[model samples]
Target: MLVSLEIERVEPLADGAPFGAVGAYERVVGKAKGEVDPAAPGNRGIALIDKAPRNASGKVEYTTDIFILRPKDFSRGNGRILYEVNNRGRKMLFGYIADGPQGVNDPKTMADVGNGFPLRQGYTIVWSGWDPDAPRANMGLGLTAPVATDSGRPIVQKVRDEFVSGTRGGALETFKLSCEAASLEQPRARLTMRERAGDEPRELPLNQWSFVDARSIKLRDGSKPRPGWIYEFHYEATNPKVLGLGFAATRDVVSWLRYDAAALAVTGGPISHALAIGFSQAGRYLRNHISEGFNRDEQGRKVFDGIHSHIAGVGRIFFNTPFGQPARTGTQHEDHFFPENAFPFSTAMQSDPLTGKSGSLFRGDGSDPKLIETNTSTEYWQKGASLLHTDPLGTTDVTLPDHSRVYMIAGTQHGGRAGATTDAGPNVNPRNPHNPMPAVRALLMALDAWVVSGQAPPASRVPTLADGTLVEADRTGFPAVPGAAVVKVTNQVAPPGDWVNPTPPAKAYRTLVCKVDADGNEAAGIRLPDIAVPLATYTGWNEYKPPYPAGELADRDGSCLPFAVDAAARQAAGDPRPAIAERYKSGADYQARVEAVVASLLADRLLLPEDAERYRERAAKEPRVAP
Candidate 1:
């Protein structure tokens, strides 16, 4: 099904990589050379963002870079390619390293991180530049796109830009979205300020804010931007890039690599099957990619056999639109008005009773891939993950299709903290410390089995309304724990008009959080040993302390509070719950409890045996647990 594919070249990795016998090479996906091949219709698709004019070739030609890391010897490799789409500029391809010996921030042994598990497994890993604006020199792949314009005129659309800073809010109106152009004659823009997410937004007089460049918007007084306040500017932006092509690029590249048999000479053979994983923004991109019918190549062959979107809530991206800003991620405070959050947020088919519109996230092109979506506890609290499994009205559970599975990692933060302990991550996020990697590793294996061996993954472990497990945030059975705010997560809604303006959702969808047990751990989903046998009361929701959208979820980070060591301590803090010291006779007792929990998880197939052992071992090392 390939239009054209060239090996470009292959090179061995420098010494001291954790990849074992694996080698790495960079592949080049170039623009079409001769007549446009339908299968490699690089930019032939319509640009929904702008009715931009194109050349006689019919579409803009794009050339980009992709990287492959596989066994140097083709015979040693499995026929599977794990295509990990980058999230922004960072590589999560090795994030599972958090579960291994070398954790993040390992400069000296970064190559040896993750214990070479993926390499030893003989799976070939590949990644390509999808987002054109993804930092190239900053260690990200490169994507080049043709500029989009309307019939000889620059297409301009009202774009919303929001900036939040903890320390350095530069003094100037130079907030550029990727690469955009503001009007030359003093662009017209409006600025608004809100000290807290709950605070009433105060509109600044038009005279107060002006653009310094496409990148920055600042006060007319020339004062430095303040920390902890949200500065939002709504202005006319022009020259939107054909960002949606990035989606097609992913499809075409994978299709060419997986189906092009010519590669067998050097790479052994075309990959038998392919899978993709995207986290956060990239995850949302995947959602938009499949939902927008980009999973199939121009020749109509499936690109990805299986898809895993992680930490992406009820959102897609402003991927392809007039003045498109594919990088803008909608949040409660930052970029809060992007098109990422839209209807049909779930993969399950259900009618939006209000609009009487019904559909699922599948393309309906018969090329929909098997999907396995996973979210952390933070999603339920912040990202409306409940929407994935529940009806839009949130009154009942929407059964997942047999081909799709939804899993929620209990008591974890967004993307989960890596190598998390009872302590929170060093990053400023205040959420609890729940490592989602072990579960992620196990689920990926399940996804591979589902695609290769036709074995269904474990039954969906998401919370449900019928079971009383999925309930409103305020309804959680959590005891009155100190320093914990079981507050409601914002439900972003909108009416029909002025898509770019701040049109609040006319009505709120039913936002639900998971129910908790006596120990304050989520009881509905896959709970690793950390929650099953806990020392601290791990939580999915963490509060913004002072500045930075106060009272909102801490940008998806969690909070971990070790239960008071003793009942006296709990009583002094006015905590109604018992303490870890009171619950477990000693660390060994905690270890035994964790072991039992691990055994149960293994039996349920929620966790693999190897992962269960790792969990047990980690629990044993916790200061609260003894050998």
Candidate 2:
């Protein structure tokens, strides 16, 4: 027989409040106070208030009077309600309440103005399947008894460490109780950043930069045979001293699904979150390399050009370098960033290296300035494959042996752009259009289905080429290569100790100004090793264009952040719609696309007629929601 459970409270806690608290009742009162009209479709009125008195030790105790709703299938007997309670809102307390006919209602009451001594403030009903020996035929009110409580100490301590010392407890406790009642599971991913401390210089290798670790915890019960799985978290760090060996690693553990694994799914935030921290740390380290001059000049322009070239060179070095080469554990070098004999132009510039021209560049004397020198053929640009083929983050050492499936995506930026917009001024836009969440979710769903059923995922589960065509899978129906590889390593040559300055000196400097033209003037200032360049050459850079107002230049300085190009610009620039659309569509579309591609592989036989109809029907249906 099917059983339905419905719970209602007369004086309920606020939207987010722990049970049995004055604030909880206050929330209900607040809702009643804000009600414009009770008859409105969405209007809800508060039903009760709570008042607590402090004891001798100044600790407050509270009691709540709430009306509980009965389930439609009520069969009175010994009924119990399973729920959780939290302290304030921080600590989680899991427990149950029991009710019976013996302790029904109390007639001894206190009288208030305009009310009787004994009042029916609220009612609660418990429902269960019909039993021949049950005490009552119809539902009735009964006394309440507390059951077991789950400790909220761990969650409360974590919040205190991460946010404030004690402010978050109440909010967290209330959230926990509400989540338990609604059957929502907390996300189980952790984002952490690790940098070498001054005392631990020996622990980190010399010349290595920083290290970031993204961990997704998978909890499992020892009694269950199911194994744990941890997906690879990407890591990237750069060190100028360690030429041709920028570190990168990505590792995914193979294992069976556990209870928590089914509830807490892997999301895209871990990889990008770790990368954001790593990149910020890298940018701080590279501050000295930034150009020290502003405006167009014979020497300053050359310096700016050189800095851009250096950044491009760094990009080439990283892209061509492979993880774990030459030595097994000791320091090793790979030319993946700077491939042996291969030019760096392919990975460095937005324009063709051979042409020396950019789509954004205009014609005239300013075009193809002789000051621009091409480093496409530099030694740093050469390409050659690395000898090492093992996982960089040492996944094989930490992950379960049973875990097998691994997927990686490459060529995408660290964090995806939320939407297309060219307004990202000086800084790199956080929201790059190439966000990997949609694709990652699709892959995870495919993995889930593959694990639950005997069927394997089709090759087209991975993203298609820039064109709107499906990429064929290997004979095994899986992609031949992993998505992307990320590595984390410390600089072995110039350890932090080498540059440690216990008594750093103070600095003093002044600003310098120069004339740009009849209506413009350029200003320059020194900010340590790095030069500060403003958005406009003379504060009138773009001549008051569509994106600029009079006397306001598109500042490249920290004042104006850089943003990615948006959809309108992409379309105008001839970007293919299908290529971009596939990245954001729902999982159903992704599944359909994969199945369509799979159908093409067996167009001649039973695979087409038998599987096509079934797959099409499944694709047409919306994703199943959990009951």
* Candidate 2 C-alpha lDDT tens digits along 221-269: 3211111100111222111011111110000000000111321121101
Q: How many backbone clashes does candidate 2 have?
A: 59
Model 2 residue 179 distance off true place after TM-score fit, in angstroms: 28
* C-alpha lDDT score of every prediction, in listed order: 0.68, 0.18
Error of 1 at 554 (Å): 2.3
Supply every candidate's count of residue pairs whose N, Cα or C atoms clash at under 3 angstroms.
Answer: 22, 59
Candidate 1 clash figure, as a count? 22
lDDT of 1 by residue, 354-417 (tens): 5667889885768889998889887777677898988887899988788899999998877564
Off by over 4 Å in 2: 1-402, 417-422, 425-431, 457-627
